[model samples]
Target: MVSSTISLAPFFSLSPSASQSQPPSPFAFRRGLFLVCHAFSQSESQADKPNSWRQLHWKEKRPRRKANAISDQEVVHQFDQLLAAKNLYQINQYLKDHAKTSNNSYPTVFSLFTRLTQAEGIGPDEYTYAILMDCCARMNQVNLMFGFLGRFLKEGHSANNAMIFSPILKGLCWEKRTGEAATIVLYKMAKLGCIPGIVSYNIIINGLCKNDEIDKAMDFVDVMMSKGHEPNVVTYNTLIDGLCKKGEIDKALDFVDVMISKGHGPNVVTYSTLIDGLCKEGEIDKAMDIVDVMISKGYDPDVITYSILINGLCKEGEIDKAMDIVDVMISRGHDPDVVTYSTLIDGLCKEGEIDKARNFVDVMISKGLEPDVVTYSTLIDGLCKKGEIDKAMDIVDVMISRGHDPDVVTYNTLIDGLCKKGETDKARDFVDVMISKGLEPNVVTYSTLIDGLCKKGETDNARDFVDVMISKGLEPNVVTYNILIDGLCKKGEIQKAIDIVDVMITKGHEPDVVTYSTLIDGLCKKGEIEKAMDFLDVMISKGLEPDVVTYNTLIDGLCKKGETDKARDFVDVMISKGLEPDVVTHNTLIDGLCKKGQTEQAFNFLDVMISKGCDPDVITYNTLITGLCKNGEIDKALDFVDVMISKGHEPNVVTYSTLIDGLCKKGEIKRALNFLDVMISKGHEPDVVTYGTLIDGLCEKGEITKAKELFYEMISKGVDPDAVI
Candidate 1:
């Protein structure tokens, strides 16, 4: 608080006028002795008693000065050097001690440096401020950093003082306190009369980009240019990288043009940033173009460049191309590292080439690249997805033996796999093992377990587990709510599902598309179509668009009610909204039409379907045939069956059995018997349904002898007839 000066004389018993004051306080004496021993130990040699502090006045002249003394230059020169050196040393030790332990000493030692230097008429140099600013930044003490900045500015420093701002900027930016960094440079530094130079601006720009403030970062680029600070490649790269990550890759590439026009041509990092952004957008070909451009610019694509392409390719399900790039990467003398191998492993696993992925892991090990936690995690996740959970656990054991600590992601994958395989009890045991290994269960971990428990028909246990998660301070996320909602729906507890949805909203959670879709589907399945419609309206009102699943569920409900026309009308609405109906939607409508005896209308729907890019599969044809048989349009159905075969669509047993049943129902018992022989010639053996359908049709026609013959033949084929037969 005493900014005027720290009178070192109060700490020492250095009083020539002894009668003027009381004895120095014990606290003052101890502090003075500590300062003398710590700072002025070298000056003690000239003391009369070599311990008596009467001659010392910190930077005071040897004896008390009245008329004249050593010149100010002589006194200041010696005192400044001594003060700066001692203060710098003390400030460094404080920083070192604080860096290792608690940094509570920041204020204590920073005050000592500034005050002692000021009292000695010596300005604290860059080294003094550098250490202090870094200490403040590391401690996240912004106020202390600004205090040092104010002092530095007061010393008439200018834009060239990067040394002052650089460390502070790095510290703030490193901690992602970029907005504060920009505040200091954009407003504070200028207010203090030190217009920020390019380095300070660059740091702030990178921070802004890092904080996802791409527009703000771009606007600052203008400020940098207006202030006559030419934006360097780093500034452009930072802005471009941010823009790309935000899915503004085109805007990023525009900056690439701007950068080159300004003569700060993009470097490896700039090109790599663009490549990564393009690849993330699934523009792998565009990324390759960028790579080619980099080579044309005499900058060879580095490992990161190729890895970005590989990652992008793999994501697009282009694993073959990703592997080709791996070969290309090796030929370029840039060996694929663990990251490269891990990405390939992940890609291969996703492509269901799990065995190939396993072999690649061994190849990585052979190449002397010890798989890190990520590599092991990728492999474990792959094995888990393939339902080789025991293999995943074995990998985990091997990973542990090799000193690779399986991260939470690894265990979560395993737990999820077990849960999906209906091993909820095993999953619970894994959760305990995870805790024993000092791995805390995160939201995903707990959520997966809750889902597993709910799936195993343990709804009460899942509800209790939610409380346990809350007790542990892990809030249930939207996925967790959706999983529980699904479980409640499956149990026919519609009210509970609605109540949970309400709770989700009350808890400040926005029910996303999945949440609404699950509720709608559940209601549809339970034949609560009107309630499902109500949910649909609420979902739209909440500004959430009804996705394909939402629309499909409602269509399915209408179709199941034999309201094919209503379902057909809903499909038009979906298309009007630019939501293309998937194959499931078309098939649902087809089946509905068939059930309502509109077999011909179902054929018309199929024609309209192919034109709209929704292909009718085997299920669609089977539904139409059943409708025809029920309508006594047996011969026309036979011609359609020939059309199906000519179109390379094989009619399975459903088609054959439907035709034979139609014939027998029409009292063409002999023709139906011959059709059965045709079915056998096509390598299609009569199963229980096929035999039952024929037997029922024959009995209804009063052809007991033919029915008995078919019954004996069915028994010879080992086809057990149902009670209906």
Candidate 2:
């Protein structure tokens, strides 16, 4: 009896290209071959007599001319179909035969599985268990991947499965799951007797640094060095990039120096990362210095490097310097990219140079670079900033014409611009358009509209907008309340403003400085000075520092109350706290003192104001002179008048009136007449009060005839005298 076997190579001899390119009818040939093999196997029996018909049939079926030539393409195609339909059960069944009979080689099937896992929305299942673990590792699902690893081990799978551990660790590092990834990597490496490569260690260290676990990353570096694993340029660059991103630019530079000392040269990526960080931090000069360093080291700054610097300078309001950088880049044969152009346009627009920004857009188009949405948005914002609403709308129209549907930002910019120009109705219309386009109005949009309404003195409408905002699921921020408070205060609705403040606090929103100051100023302006003081006390108790405007309002209110002593004490308290009182604070106190007949005290404050490094303005001296004359300290008042003259402050009508009123009160009518002559000589016309005071003094001296003559003279001079005087 002869031993027999069957070959399936003849069926596979048909080329895949021929099968794919031709009709479906050729598939019948392959199906017929399978049927013939099945029939032959069914008819034959293993136990048979020598030279039996079954043995002859088996011998004829074995090998023939096409044995040992079967490819695994058909098996791979079936596996793909199963994987595509996510039929993991069928895949496991097929894999069982392929695993045992095919020398365990399934590269084609495994490759197909790898591609499927990489597809967006496709994921891994249990039958492709090893592949699923790899996918989990790639996606940084370390815990899930490790959990699967444990199940795989418990199911008595081979230890060669440990090969999946490194890739998993790498995935963890990439996903910034560093600490956990590192721990697992180290433990598994030890358990499997595997040593992590430099790339693996570098990845772990990079992740640690990114997480701001720099110390751990550095410790790992030290451990790697101790274990004789040399750190490469990539290792140093990773550390540098991480440090720069965390705003540790100086430390990053120091790392560069250390890298140089360790014979590892810094690469363009290292410099670019540092420059980008510096630019973002508003250290543009430092970033430029790094750019020079890169150039001197024979590294041409890339588009990103220049963009960073340009953006940094633009943000810092150094548009001219940013333009200079652009010129240098162009001069160095580097064509400005869209980002570079957008930065300049944004900076110019922000600086109120909309025309210049438009010119740049023309230049960008001439250079053959089509402006993107960012470019359009930047120009729109620029136009808005320059108050060029029509032009901005044109840009939006053009953007739409170019088939670039305006995003929420574009609408937001226009709405904000309209609101700023007090076009709340138009802004609201745009808001409706935004919602109609399926874009939800965010907090900024509502806040801008509310603020615009409040500015127009439409507090009720502003409050209504607030309700609309809340109904739309948007929470009002601190700014919303501040605007309402301001509006209510301006309308003399101080109590309502206070009620809003209470509501704000109840809603868990802490009252900011603006909140307290708005209410305080409103109270002070309404002559509710005591209530404002109570608010100040509450503000201080809440740990909020009163700003200079807060102090000024309080001092002005106290001055109005004729409480100069208390006002001065508040000024002293402000000074002791290192809060310098402004000229208004001094003027209020001096006017209060002069009104209270404390002319000498008022004069002293004038000098105190000068000594406190606040120059006495015309108001300061005028208030003091008026206070002194009202108190019958005419001589001292005259001296202040001279001081004001010497200080180049021209004496106006109030100055002459104070002098004339003071002299008349002292019975020095003739001298008052002399002062009036001098006043007119200096081209200072005597007002009605000046004439009235002198006329009243003449009447007191039995010169009624002279008083009547002066009264007629006052009418002739066009000075309307108050009837009481």
Candidate 3:
């Protein structure tokens, strides 16, 4: 007799306060039972009220039963048939038995409850409420699910069965309320005399793993084992996956051993996950060993497994090994898919083997596997990076021909390539094309454009692009700011670059090590050594360690300012900071020492450099030779050239030019001409400096005809004479 338009809001309002900090106690759920039952009882009481218009209307609408009316058994049987068929609408109609429907009707379960109470043969039961609870859980309506649970408990159907609470545990976990799910498994179900089964524990553990609470998830495994519930393969696999994702591959492997010893043999998913973890850690060889072990265990690697191996090998630059794996995969009858081919192509491209990469694309099509968007994009990126911008565009055209639209990533790659080639204008034009194709330029797109402009010395344009990027709602990230700062610094606009850093900080962007290093380099270039040194101190204070480049820049600056001793001290400081001096560091220091006329001291540093296992490059030998030549040690300088050649360092044009200048300075005009001939014969073309030195030498030796002939020969060889000539 009650109106079917019953509201469950008042019952839900009786739920624990939303503002309650702690989780609701088991007593709170018990208290909720009374509140929900009270609501149901109130509705029934109003319908039963004597002299009530609702009761009168209900009496008039009552239909008389036939002689062959359906029995309670028959009704219950029909309800089960409908439930099995999942015919919710028919179930509602059969419960109501020709009752009037209303706009504000309650949900299907509540309507069934209301009608079954009024039905002739049967009423709502514990089994019926279980179905209702499941419905609420499936719909992700956890509050409604709890209300059904409260109703189930109130009706004295609180049996010691875990299935009844399964829906509750599942609903809580699905809503990311894993903590509540755990409470139900650990305490609430126990308090209700329901033993939590393996299913219940696994759901909670999987939920915890998903929440990244791996350690807490492991604790639950211990709790379940203590409670006499053996952890199954699903349980172990869940824990292993969590450990692998957290980069704890060793722990994941340990879990696998535990699983094996417990008679739950490691499955393909287990091996695949471990392999992926090892590959991510750059242990490609170990990952391959894992694959061999998987095969020994009678598990044939699937396409996904093989693909993972191929990807690992490719990442380690073992392209040939990756190809061999693909061959082995094919021999085992696992056809290489697009991902496998794409990964190989990417590896080849990274190694600068573009032609080989392109051949694989054809092979993929021959295998009847069409390349996806990712495959096309990766190939495009590789081509662009190789400075093959035209070829990359052709591939984009081919991609369109194949009915795949070039995505933002494809456009961004093209723009970056053009920018690196110093074609900023062409790169900017790609943005308009990208927008035309309905693909909005993301942060990478705008940042690449800004970088292009900055590198081209168009800092003002780059700044304007930053403003435009903000206007378009794309906030410049730290990389974008760094590019702009680097540009200004390179332009010798140190003050403007410093101001940009201030603005960057104001915008909540913290300057990283690169930012401080760039600032220091700029200060050093501007001869602001004290300020540069202060910036270095500030950098270290902020917990940003100066890299080798930073130390080398400062050293180079000090040496240029006639502070060779200070530069040498910085090398010691760099070593103390745990940064080993690279070749550039040695070269910078040697050049600094040589410029200060400390040729013998520079030789001492070279010995120290070799002792430290830092091999002297051609620049090192050239610096020492220049220092000796300036000290008028032509014989020693020439001997040093032999030492350079003997050490497997070929004498470059600079080497030949330096020797010629040394000989010319010593008034050995004939010897200088012979050195020039030796320079030419070694395929080292005489640059303007080389030609100019020989020409000056000839003119000074009173050989006017020979000097004019050499000058004309230099011009014929396309070596432009400088003002020094």
Question: Best-fitting candidate, measured by TM-score?
Answer: 1
Runs off by more than 4 Å, candidate 2? 1-259, 262-264, 273-286, 543-725
Point out the worst 10-residue segment of candidate 1 by lDDT. 49-58
TM-score of candidate 3 to 2 decimals? 0.74
lDDT of 3: 0.80
Reference-based TM-score of each model: 0.76, 0.60, 0.74
Candidates 1 and 2 compared by TM-score, better number: 1
Return model 3's CA RMSD, one decimal.
Answer: 14.4
> Each candidate: how many clashes?
0, 0, 0
476-528: candidate 2 lDDT, tens digit per residue: 88988998999999989998899999988898899988899999899988989
TM-score of predicted structure 2: 0.60
- For candidate 1, what is the TM-score? 0.76
Instruction: List the candidate 3 regions with Cα displacement exceeding 4 Å.
Output: 1-256, 715-720
RMSD in order of candidates:
15.1, 20.2, 14.4
Per-residue CA lDDT of model 3 for 1-725, tens digit only, reads 32344333322222232321222344564364334444444443233222221232223422223435555566567766766666556665665551223211224335445545556544555555555565455444566566666556665676487777777777777778888788778876776788889989999998888789999999998999999999998899899888987899989998898898989999898898889889888999899999999999999999889988888888899999999999899999999877788778888988988899889898889879888666777788788888999999999999999988876667888999999999999999999998888767777888899999999999999999999999987788889999999999999999899999899999999999999999999989999999999999999898988999999999989988989889989999988989999999998888988888899999999999999999999999999999999889999999998999899999999998998999999999899999888988999899988888888888888998999999999999998899998
Q: Which residue pairs come into collision in candidate 2?
A: none
